[model samples]
Target: MSKTVGAEGWTVVHQARQKHYDDRYYGQFLGTRKDGRWIVGRMWSGRSMDDGFHDGGWDWSKRFAEPSSTDAADAALKSYVEMSHETFVWNRVFEQRVGEAIDAYWAGPEVPGAPRLSAGWCRTPDGLPGGSTVGLPFHEAKYRLLQYLRSTESTARADLSPRTFNLHDAVELIRQANGPFRFQHGYNAYWLADDAS
Candidate 1:
């Protein structure tokens, strides 16, 4: 009866939250067929065990929320596409895109040929870019964002692993941080963008 949201009626929802993602990625997406109906209760799409998966008992469950309006349904669908887009990517490299293209960005010595992040990338008053043509990796974006947040808001920095994400995730973070992903090192230090963004 519905063709809007990412998951439709009688669907399953799965969320696995852990201290780290380096483990076997064991998780489960349970569905129920009871009371003369198959109710989709849980869903997952990641590396798991041959037998199945678990969320340390706390990494699972289900819920149902009916949108009151068509606009609300469309918004929910947009959120679904943003979250599950990885399942439809064309390649591993494509999976890691931050903005534009990964190659349009670089983390090494440039030869005046690549299209790096520049003034045009950031427009928000809080996201002013530096006067350079350097781009950054996801982790570096994390590092720099932390610095900016702590500096501007007196917020305590969390102990986050910088290399725990792909380029696209990092770019999103940098943009959220109001634009502070510019490289402060010399041109020879382009390689540091990933570890330092």
Candidate 2:
């Protein structure tokens, strides 16, 4: 039997466990009443001072907004959200905002606190797709491939069999490497292998 909790117009859809003392909280989801927008975030308090990431009085706080209900639903299923705000503030205003959000999410008739988070940075590796690179240039794609090889054990191989690399191949390789990646065009694969070697 799951106990339901709410406050203001927002509902607490999902709450993740606090695995470590340094972690203030993990994957938190707050959904609005009428709007489909959801606030998803996490906070690394660094209370233990293990990583020396203390900024004035606060550590890293990350928040993300999902506009569509479908995205919100998908996010609720995940253990933690991917992208996060790399910046930190001196005061606990950001922390307070998240607390208010949690309160409204559990308690009913008021608006939750909204934090003004700037555009976040991608903490992912150099070669991987940070988000979407649909219109990424071929030269850039080639550079990423080389970077990926340099970082990982996987080496680029030149295939002279004349077979086209599809989405499945790319996915399999990424799975083996245990990371995200972007693919270069078919014609550039041979040259990419040469560069990697």
Best by lDDT: 2
Cα lDDT of model 1 by residue, 1-197, tens digit: 11111332322222221222455333323221111122212234345433232332223333323332222222333343343333232234322222112112212123243223322122233444422233544334333343332222212112232433323333334434332334221111111132223
**TM-score against native, each model:** 0.19, 0.24
Model 1 scores a TM of 0.19
* C-alpha RMSD between model 1 and the true structure: 16.0
Clash pairs (backbone) in predicted model 2: 6-106, 6-107, 7-106, 7-107, 7-108, 8-108, 8-109, 8-110
Q: How many backbone clashes does candidate 1 have?
A: 7
